[model samples]
Target: MNIRFDLRQVRAFLAVASTLHFKQAAETLCITQPALSRLIKGLEESIGAELFTRTTRQVELTVAGRLFLGECQQAITHLERATHLAQQAASGDIGHLSIAYNDFSINGVLPSILDTFKEKYPDISVDLVYMPSHTQHKALLDHEIDVGFLIGPLDMAGIQTFRAALERIVVILPRRHHLADRQQLYIEDLKDEKFILGTENGWREFRQYIFNICIKAGFTPQVVQEASTSSGIFGLVAANMGVSLYSDCINRFQRDDIAVVPLDHDDYSVETIAAWSMSYTTPSFRLFRELLESRLGGES
Candidate 1:
């Protein structure tokens, strides 16, 4: 037979079993004694068993009632836990988020933002994935990631974006380079110098920015070597492979072999932006976005 009992019937049975007194169980259930009795009678009938042996002086559980009591209590406990977890999920307190970041952002403010978010919502799981800026643009559009921190001004239809950092361009050169002694250098000064840059696959957007700045400076960069990551680029620069134009975020790293000098032009700056698709926001992502909004508001 199909079990046709409802929560109220289960609760009424539990209350009566706990008290062993009909009047007390009725009071515990906040129902009239007659109503409580109807619930228990319906529950027992549905289960095909007599749950209690009623006496004028005392009410006692039958063998079936004793067995039902233990299992019923456990079921109620599990149900309550399920309800609590569902509530937490709805309130953005527990969930999972896939977040993408590029080299520049992971080395900058993204870490602090993630730390603060994790502290606030300890149960929410965050998976950080490294993705190039151009790849992140596609990932955001395809709903593959919840958020992306990458090179900015991501003007796309369905994607929302906000500037996360504005870093001035700087030159990273070998310490012994002739121009490294200058307090500041202009992009034009690097026109004749060999450069070590990131490869086009992983650093296409950033490379484009660098190329544009150099082109505006009236000369193309002489790329002597290409590295796939920031560390590789730094290692190449340290070996005197070439000097590279990069964001001032290089200051965050301590490298005795390389000098980071400010670029003289005010027109060029590396902008990092946080991007997300409005269509793919989950409860966890909403919480993170709210935190980002508050942080951005404070800065503004």
Candidate 2:
């Protein structure tokens, strides 16, 4: 009589009462049948009432159980709404957003996106972190970053993504390089050249694209150096270390020593996407997305 009833017991009882079968209830509750039975027994004992009548084939809730189930349902719904409201309050429309972006995003796309977003929602704070595409994806999955701007398509579960822009990859080479004089270059033209590429395994798809294009052109590239940041890669190319491929946004660097040549192949285009967890999107997140879409001409 002195034992206090717990929410767990109420939830268990409600599950059983709704289904009218202990085995089915146990399955729904993700508990063993014996554990569910024991919980119901304890709940009944605490209330000094029998909640259900059970047979080998089926179970039926008693009058007291039906009434209790109704109350339990109401209580659970209220608790859920209250929890949601509290979360909303904590993440005000003017809350901090942890964002992960990469080199291509940092130069122009992100600045434009943020300029529009801040004008619309000046109270919202953004914490921008520059990371590789692979690192950004992992950070989003771990909840370390609230949103990510990177290349797609990411096939991770529980993450929702939308394409923000389609950019073409251009070849960046030393101004004096032979291909630098050409108005346009094809993947086959880069064969037998020493390349400066982003670190392998860090930007998986991008690195793969470079290798795939080279293989399709009948030779593996002799990579001269690998850099993690786009600036570093461009700097190396400017120093005549090796030619590299980069998105059109790289033109913002404007290094006199490096010349950018547009690629003529369809596979040379890249898609930038915005991604976030389905369970953690807030009003601020939606607003940020709206601002980005507006700035990007509603591409997403």
Candidate 3:
């Protein structure tokens, strides 16, 4: 038994074991009858057992061959499954994606887009991380997150950005406030009001944009209070801790005490974009990009 057994020999054995006919097995294996006989002989010689019993008219597996057949079937099935899984992974049909998002994104178009993605690519598992825009931006650079739903241009080094959506910044005002019923609130109108601004460590681009809007209106906002949470911000606004600016989609958090009113200026909007570190462009990333493009259509 110095001869070695290989996959082709096992395959030849399985074919012969299955049909129990040398001529038919040779046809199935696309080999000559003599060649098939040689392979089965080699395999039986290596195993030191007679795998088949033959009369001129019929062939049959011995007890040993029957047991070996079960094991061979399992081995072939497992090998086929491994090959399939590898192919699926390479095609980005099966894998894990680490995604980061802020409050604005999860509340707005992100949910619908995610639903569509799930329908198409069910095998791709998503790891959803919640963080503010600044943190998400930093995480993308550090390779902690594969994709980020963030605000602003995010024109930082090594980051590729795709603007996903643009939503107007709306005012979150106490319902009883005089300006709440107005058709639209101008940035100038809130100059004297004690504004509830975002904390310094939060959305940097958005905070600066709001400041620029206030500066254009001839006065800086008076920051009376600060909170990092969206629900907390809404609570603050409901309490009249002062009105604040938020993307219009967050009006879903509207309350009896707080009113959502749009800004008068057309430029007063926030850009929700997708960002990734340059190295993270994989098939999973392309699937996510396609989902956004499908939903927004020319907007992404």
Candidate 4:
């Protein structure tokens, strides 16, 4: 037998099945009881089956009605899911977004990115992975992450990059240090200081920047310690472990025992970049990149 199914009939079936009363179902569906009764009668005739056993006092489902109700429930659930999926796809919210960035990005830029992205497309679920700059680059190469926020001069093949911002590196010192009283300090002033550096192996740009600045100022830094994160490095500095070079964002850590001093030299700045695998540059990723570029003042 050829049977036609309409969404309206499915909706009417679900409403009547749930309420077990034509008057109640009509009220829920915002239609009159007579109109609802007509719809249900047409639906039952279309399927060539009796869906309800009605009496003067009460109405109940027949065996066929019970089975049809189950099918109607499943159909309604699938329809709702389909509608949600369609809406998500229309608004660029259905796909997976794998983002990799260093810990500094989380403190400095991620909050704004998340806020804007959520406001624009609240259904797009994002997976954020934090790694050192080198590891983020490697993950992008491996196609494990869709986008990367890295501190550069990155020279990697098969990756497309756009420079975002140039962030000035600052010296983090114990609040009681004598140099902390100065508004700014030159690299030469820190020549004899025992320096704490973060991520010696993975943060090539920052690690090299620190070493080169110290060498240009006429002495090798006396290395006192190494840490893998901004918080750890700043925590060590706060405890007076040693002075450390860090980005301006580290000041937001708000540790009472630590103070930030600006570097007097211009070359100590690090450039942040947005990078992605050349192969996975979809329109959605491009739009996201544009959003980031706008935030960084690099949008064309």
Query: Which regions of candidate 2 fall more than 4 Å away from where they truly are?
Result: 1-93, 297-300
Estimate TM-scores for all models.
0.68, 0.68, 0.66, 0.66
lDDT of 3: 0.83
Question: What global local distance difference test value does model 4 have?
Answer: 0.79
Best by lDDT: 1
lDDT of 2 at 10: 89
What C-alpha lDDT, on a 0 to 100 scale, does residue 4 get in candidate 1? 93
Q: For residues 155-238, could you state the per-residue lDDT of candidate 4 as single tens digits? A: 788888877667788999999988998999988998878888876675666888788878877899888888887778888888
Better of 1 and 2 by lDDT: 1
- Tell me which of candidates 1 and 3 scores higher on lDDT: 1
**Pairs clashing in candidate 3?**
none
Cα deviation of 100, candidate 4, in Å: 0.4
Candidate 1 structure lDDT: 0.88
Look at candidate 1 and give me any clashing residue pairs. none
Q: Over the stretch 1-300, how does candidate 3's per-residue lDDT look in tens digits?
A: 454799999999999888889999999999999999999999999898999999999999999989989888877865764575578679976765778988788988688788888888888878898888988876886567779998867778888887788899999898888898998988888988988867777656677888988898899988889887778888899898899999999766547889888998778889888888886465677888777776676432
Candidate 2 structure, TM-score to reference: 0.68
Off by over 4 Å in 4: 1-93
Q: lDDT, candidate 3, residue 109? A: 66
Alpha-carbon shift of residue 281 in model 1 (angstroms): 0.8
Ranking by TM-score: 1, 2, 3, 4
Q: Whole-model Cα lDDT per candidate?
A: 0.88, 0.82, 0.83, 0.79
- Give a tens-digit lDDT track for model 2, residues 133-235: 8888767765667789888888898988887777888999999998898999988888878899888655667888778888988989889899987878888
Please identify which of the two predictions, 2 or 3, would achieve the higher lDDT against the true structure.
Answer: 3
Writing each residue's lDDT as its tens digit, candidate 1 over 27-140 gives: 988899999989989998899999999989999999999999988886786577457658867997668788999999998879888999999988998889999999998788
